[model samples]
Target: MGKLACFCILFFNVQLGLCMAPDLSILIVTYNSRRDIEKCLASLRDNSRGARVEIIVCDNASSDGTANFIAQHFPAVNLIRSAHNLGFGRANNLAAQHAHGRFFLLLNPDTWVEEDLAAAIVNFLDTHPEAGGCTPQHLNPDGTIQVGAIRELPTVESLFYQKTGLAYVFPRSRRFGRYCMTWWDHDEVREVEQAGACLALRREVFQQVGGFDESYFMYFEDVELCHAVRAAGYKIFSLSYARVYHIGGQSAKQAVSKNFIEFYRSMCHYFRKHYGAAGVWPVKIIIAVSELLMLLVLTLALPFSKLLPPPQAWSSRWTQWRGHARLLREVWTF
Candidate 1:
């Protein structure tokens, strides 16, 4: 269709009330999130002043009653229930299929919204035409501002620092901790490379770059998406004034071992996908070295396990790293 013809069709559709996009479409992909969804929805309802919003929840085959709970309690939600777990990126992409809004907000089901979050973000996007997406300040459950809310794109150097414990050891060093942007307090509105928790993007950004990379499955998908968004000439921002409280890691808390593997696996895939074939090797090597370092520490600590204040911590650490060792072996051979 020609641009004029498409515009006319859209105009007529809106005029006749047949098709009209809301100001914001909130997408939440829930996996066993029945415990968190209610509070999340209630906060959106009570907050989000002066913005037309539609909530869509894609339930990724939750064993818990998440789909049923949304269907019963939140009739307004456009709920799409997948027959199997589609992971984070794919599940959100599935939910976006039903989204009709000027902007799309990717929110976790465990998040609580602040007053007028949607309206404020809508206004910000409206004014800042150059910005393709923005993230509000993320807060922890205890009401402290979350660290690593905004960050630089991950590089091989950053990955090495992160995986080898150098980032944690020298958090204030800009070179060592650049991945987490640890040197700066995240209190100002500025252009950022990635939004860690919640992200809101203009509809056109999706139309250009499409949704999160499905291959990611879970982690680093947002980073890939933001990279694509920026590469497409759209700037992203951290809107520090607006805020959302995140009950982080609700889903990952379910299966720690599986989640850990997926985290590294996705990281490796992300490096390869964006940084080319050679990128995967550095990430794999960093992970392998980290695992080896952990093994060394565990071997030294094994004799003193009983003397540790929490004796169970030593045992859990051993169990955790045992899985990591297996993962490292697989990575090397694969």
Candidate 2:
């Protein structure tokens, strides 16, 4: 049948008695997330407003016995325990493959939802046909707007600002803060390039993108996926209504060094993938030189000690810097 005829037929059919099945699956990839998963799951359960959301938890062989904890406490949760740590991308993909729902929610185990988050997202997608994915507004434990919740695509200037901490100096500047969309008030519905933490998309988009790039391993997978979805002619929306209290760095706290390395490694890979050979070289150089400067700064600050977190352990800060340096080396060689 023709396009108009098909549309009319479906419209009439839906008007008569067409009822679709429940099609929302919340996919959370967990790694040593026991500290936060309970609250996360509880919030989902409490705030779902009786909507049927298939919650799938993918455990990445956490040493902290997170899988057993979930199994013991939340018997209703469908948990997939991997024998070894498959990282975030592959673990999520593993669950996505097993998911029967049409809408996939790539959520973090550290996030606690507000009332009816699933319903709001599903409703948005149902109403706005162009939106390929929607990310909720991020709130910290204290209810402040969370940084790193959403971000713009990488550019030499934005990347440089983000790395050297110039973005903090001009947190409200459109150009300087473009990397994280920090200038926005978090009160409007708008299209965004990337949703760093929580993202919801239909199964068709997931199939078309073939899920996240496994090369990312952890970070920037969302940004890469958002890029692919937009390239496929779909809009990515940031909805202010669906709020999530994000306990950032829940998984990264386990091994700060490893996650630090993966962060830069993924950043380099993302740049290389998005920006071709011509565009990748400058970013590589910027990353190298800027990292060297940061290494020196952090080394000098290591002794002063009172500036950052973990008040007593300056050693931990130094250790993280060492890991970052290793990542810079890997990126430079690549």
Candidate 3:
């Protein structure tokens, strides 16, 4: 009778231990992302196996009935509807506060993960104690690679070169090379400074770094977070084992001017925060001049460019004008 009681107690303890293990909480922030939210959640729900995981959708007051759709369709999702768009950083931070998982994945609503993506990230983080965060290789909706993951932080010169298309002209110049990862083919895993759209971070490391900085309203927040993580002695890595399909530019394409302003402002915030006011001023001026030149070129070319065929000419001229205007607004406002 004594031996049987001891065995029963040990068995119960083992079961309790297994039950007590925590799961991952995938946190996705949405702002008028109704078009992609359903697909994103579905992919996550169907794919996240082998590890315990929960989905948290933090909606930034999307007027598009995004919250209602999720509530009705994805009953298992933990949804938090905000009163206003609190930008990406703050919304994710709000969701993270309620996340009960051992790890938190900051995913964009426009991205879809592979079935094993979450499990692979969990396994990688489990083995890599020094890694603070990890991101998967991102593919476009058409299966093309996206050029976002970069090893170097954006300096004023790098930004200028990239913005003005000088990098494409002289890809080998040290200044131009810094902007575009001149050597990277986007096929392999490598150390990256930031991967904003799809990234997973250990809860402890995330909390220790105080999460994403709210000062950055939209852009450069991920890069800033990476800097903070590295400062805290944690490594940021890109994992090739996992993949995500990113439907890029849904939000930014909405209003070109506002989006451009916010993006450039975020860039300025990043530069000033890291490189100081004095160092960033020169770069700011250069960016401003380059933007002015671009605007002049676009304004002069738009009329002539519009003389082509109806479909092709209209699209070509409109896109060129929009691109130039966006660049000018970003450089000057931010």
Candidate 4:
């Protein structure tokens, strides 16, 4: 009878060990994202394989029934509800604190993954030890390739060329124009400098770099993180095998004014950190003058240009300038 009890105890321990095995954790930061969160969760549930994966929803005080809906429908999801909105970087950081996986997928609530995406990314990273992060090719709802993956960081000149449509004038010159690789039809996998929409990182690398910088409230956080990862002797890659669909602008559309303001502020933060105040100051002044001139042109042309529809576009530009102006003002005062 004692021998029989020992055998049963051993069997129970084995089962417990199997059940406690760690898995990849998908961390999603959400705020009033009821419209697309369901679809996002459904995609993850369908696609995840090989790894024991867990979904974590870090909700930033979503009042539009986001929390209750996830609790009812996605009972398997680990929910962390914030008392107030902590913005994107902080919210994702909150979820990462509780992750138990070897790797972590920082996903947006409005993005849907393909069935093989998670597995493909895992395989790629497994083979490439130097790769710090992997992101799939993102597609718009209309099946067009979104330019989320890029080879170079946008400089002040690149921004000016892209904004003024001068990039189109010198299409082939890499130095004088934007070399977006927008027309490239190659299916080959390539190393990328940035991946803003969807990215997966090794838990170790994330810890080494200390995760996303909270100084950046929203925009350019991914770029900054990528820069840090590369500086730490890691590579960032864009895998062609994996794919995801991003319902772009969900968060931005919700709070248009605030989002624009925050985006410029984040950009300034990035500029100051990477480039010296002397270098960024000239660019800021140029951007301010160019934007004001564009706004003036749009205001005057509002009566005649229906095809161009300058007012709305111009207002958006003006808002961005105003945001940049605020950042410059703060920096100058400091």
User: Which candidate leads in lDDT?
Assistant: 1
Whole-model Cα lDDT per candidate? Answer: 0.85, 0.83, 0.80, 0.76
Task: Give every collision pair in model 1.
Answer: none
C-alpha root-mean-square deviation, candidate 3: 4.3
Q: How well is each residue in 1-334 modelled by candidate 2, as lDDT tens digits?
A: 6999999998988865424434688999988888899999999888886455888999999888899999999998899999998978899999998786768989999889768898888888889988888889989999998986887777878988886788999999998899888899989999988876689999899889889888878887888888889889988898987898887876776676777677777777888887776777888888788778878877877887666565232247767577657866877765
- What is candidate 4's lDDT per residue for 142-259, written digit by digit as tens? 7677753454566777767765667667655665444464544426687777777788899999889989998877788877888888889888788876788887878887766667
lDDT of 4 at 200: 88
Better of 1 and 2 by lDDT: 1
RMSD of every candidate to native, in Å, equals: 4.3, 6.0, 4.3, 3.7
Q: Which candidate is the best by TM-score?
A: 1
lDDT string for model 3 (1-334, tens) is 9999999999999998668655688999888889999889998888888888888999999998999999999999999999999988999899999898888888889998766788888898898887888888888888777765444677776777776788878765666766556656666767777777888899999999999899887877888888898888888788866789998777886665567667767777888888897777766787778778877876777687647554322246667567656666556545
TM-scores, all candidates, are: 0.90, 0.88, 0.86, 0.85
> Residue by residue across 212-305, what tens digits does model 1's lDDT show?
8887888888889999999999999988789999988788778777777777777778778777887678778878888888778777876776
Q: What lDDT, from 0 to 1, does candidate 4 have?
A: 0.76
Per-residue error for 78 in candidate 1, Å, reads 0.9
Q: TM-score winner between 3 and 4, please give it.
A: 3
Which of candidates 1 and 2 is the stronger one according to TM-score? Answer: 1
Off by over 4 Å in 3: 1-22, 149-151, 170-175, 308-334
